[model samples]
Target chain A: MNITSVPFLFLFLPICLLFYYLIPNKKSLVLQNVFLLLVSLFFYAWGEPIRIFYLCILIVVNWLLGCFVDGKKGTKLGKWIVFIAVLINVGSLFVFKYLDFTLENIGFILGQELPLLGFTLPLGLSFFCFQAISYVVDIYRGKVKSTKNLLNASLYLSIFFKMTQGPIVQYNQFESQLISRKTTWTGFCDGFWRFAIGLAKKMLIASNIGYVVTDIFATDTASLPVVSAWLGCFAYMIQIFFDFAGYSDMAIGLGKMFGFEIPENFNYPYISTSVTGYWQRWHITLGAWFRDYMFYPLTLGPAIRMRKFLAKKKVNKNVAKFIQNLFVTGCIWFTTGIWHGATWNYVVWGLINGAFIIWELYKKPLKNKKLDSALGWLYTIAVAFFTKAIVCTPDMGSAFSYFGSMFGLNGNSLVSDTTLFYFREYWIFIVIGTLACFPIYTKIKEKLVNNSNNSKKVKTILYGIETVALLIVFIISIAYSFKNGYTAFIYQKF
Target chain B: MQEKIKEILGELLIGVDLSSKTLADDGYIDSLIVVNLVSELDLEFDIEIPFDALVNENFNSVEAIEALVKSLQK
Candidate 1:
């Protein structure tokens, strides 16, 4: 069911695209919307046949809740409705995703075993739940009105391109497109090129480097050499970015092909000079979601009240403000950490990011822009490189052991045979993947293709070359896809 | 009111230009700064800026902020 799989690329997508375009564009898109809804449901069912029913129930519940909130807008009932909607969305998420983790922790604390109810989390439960919450909350906020049409709501929640993984498009951002959109030949061609690029990134770069990362991480961390440990961490850092961002690009391109404009999820995050800047670029929609839905509400509502209370008690103004900021930042990072998984390592990873960002916020503003940026880049990369070890490891023990190896604290040698082997095998992939993380290729392509001074013949030749290049990339990616069988996107687990 | 708002912004965001048209959009004033600014404005004007008013347009520029405060006051 993965978009990169043979069946999806050769069969499902082609069939879906053919049928989707067969429907004529009219003033009303009910027929198209209905068709997409059915296709999306089928896509989800392909993987999680039983869970698709649960998804349908959630869609219906959220749709009704949205209508109710809209109907009761500006009333106490509206607030309560939105609250209940959040509870339902979050409650279901907790039951499916976090209940077992919670139970295990409780059992540990009590020194007794507890019977655990194991539930397989539905595909994209985290993403769809967030989308559902945003829909109801936006209705209550009057930012967007609820749609009376159930098909449109269902399509919004289960759109095949964004259902499993997302740029997490907000309801208000997508509501208009659901009503009316145009599918142009130019858009389709652009989308195909973008999809090809994403496929190449995933197949040619991430999948190739991922094998080395897996091999290194699987080795005994206590004996893992310094070079091998660092190589593993660095390779994982590259693997995750290309894996998730490539999937995002494919999703966005698919949306474009279908005449929908999904918001971008990444913005060359590695180029960022600070943790704060990095979050703003990476998983942009999720950060914006947390900011608007979680951060702002907590800060503006409770944090403000707390600050006022502290001010009345004669607390120093800066001290009070710092406390408020600290409280808000702590809450955000804790939730962000746990949201990634029910793992403690992810929790620590989130908190580490939060701590650095807070330090940056409170640190004295740098006066020299150039020097500050250089230092910031170094600081950011170092932090990211270390924290990525935590993300890639199974637990804190393994993470610490891995870190020990990385820093030569484990009596590990600086270079090992395994490290040399990995380098010899994957040097090209490592170099290309590292360079691809930046926007250098995009810049070069833009300069060559978009320079107005280029003659018409030259431009035509450039386009021809570009088309051939994309075709080659697409063919190679497909070959890799067939060889690999089913390489799931890393983000799909979340 | 404008002078008071300007003084507060200057204190919170030192060295940042106040005349820029897209302060929030351009990342000059991020979420942390917005939180600080909101608390300061709440204390200074004794006006609670509603959550819905926290959009980028309301805080993208000094003039936009002034207008938002003015309208909220009414």
Candidate 2:
């Protein structure tokens, strides 16, 4: 069930909170963890019960691997066992996520129909599977001690806060927080405020804009006006920011409420002045996870090699540096895109992003950094918007068609009959939605909160007003939830 | 040595001032600048810093940072 759904927000959360608070203070952590796990299992099993068994299998196998690695700590054979376990974990992901896509493409090229063993993708399979792989790898690397408690480890792997969408919490990061932490009254207040804000963003803004975007995009191309297409795409960009950002905010808020400080996932990304900066702010935890665990390690190898070569003056440092950087950057983006889904469009999206970033890096010697940042940001946003159009499309051919219409290159005139009609309908939402992406509201809230210290009366008045505003937003969001027939979370498909 | 470390910390902190009274005793460096400072120190010195390194026991004063840097240099 979506965190935004009525049952989740009104039913499950209230019940959980009531039980959580009722637990004796000393044993609260154990009680809270148990409640969260049972709820998490129900949450996952809500729509897809078949996938539940597979998830349990993963939990058991990975838990066993962690135990095995911990058991053979001093033995030389332990390393190889860890490797085999990790390989099997990763292998499962590779096959399930990529198998059909690979077979279909290969079959097309080889001029023969490959026997398609059709498989239904388990919900959040890719995300949780990666989480499991990271857990085992961390244990093997001695970054974290292997948990002897399988149930606690299982809870860590399938925690409700991130079971569906993820910041992909690390075992080490989680273990520290999960063991002993007291949730303060202040923390509960903070989490409640954050969750309420996210719910409002999703229900009021994102859901509304999404309707306009979906309406325009889902219409037949022949019936669609050119202006409508642009409007739809623009609306989509806004919808995605609020929808995903809202979800991430709620997840973080939920984590906070549960005494786990889930990392911030979005950081006013729309205001970023460069593509790299945008990536830094957007899906922040995911990007950092890949950078730390994937990109840095890959780059470090070549950097060390270059450091050695430079010590002897054996290689051209500049050339070696460029090649090393290019390879790492390429691989990072390739994985970044592929990690989103098993689609060629996603791969192309990654390549396109990598290419832009590489070009930005290439021109660094000649270009002014600030000017390049501004231009590069514009270029990146433009590229990203169009790439998202590709991502949103079902196939490559239609993506090309969409791209064609975007430029008015397919003999479509800007001032055509269709253009004016779309502009008339969606112009206001398109403009307003774009403005909401930055830190305006956050800045406003900060100002009020900062000024709350000036007077007791003033602080009370301000907080009371803010609470009322939040309550109104919550009510409106609930009202808007049924606009579409319970839109299962976008990240749940991952 | 402590003064030198404070100067470096000042440069790293940008608009914020680090004082003798506030630097170690109070929590003036609790927010954005601390994160940046921690990363810069780690990257500049090439050492893995446990999260606790930012707190009073070792990083409580400028002398602490300098001593930490000197030890790493060794």
Tens-digit lDDT track of model 2 for A183-292:
77889888888888887777776777776776666765433455666766777778888888888888888877866788888988777665665776788878757755
lDDT of 2 at A149: 77
Write model 1 residue lDDT over A1-494, tens digit each, in one string. 78999999999999989988989967547888999999899999999999899999999999999998885766999989988999999999999999999998999999999999999788899999999999999888898889999998999999998999888989999999999999999999888888888888888888999999889988988889998998897898899899989998899899989999999999998989989999899999999899888999898789999989998999999899889878998899989998898889999999999899878776666799888888888899888899988988889999999989988999989998878999999999999999989999678867766776765766788789889988998999999999998988788888
Candidate 1: segments with Cα more than 4 A from true spot? A445-452, A455-461
Positional deviation of residue A109's Cα in model 2 after best superposition, in angstroms: 2.4
True lDDT of residue A231, candidate 1: 88
Top-TM-score structure, candidate number: 1
Scored by CA lDDT, what does every candidate get? 0.89, 0.70
Candidate 2, lDDT over the whole model: 0.70
> Residue B40 error for model 1, in Å?
1.0
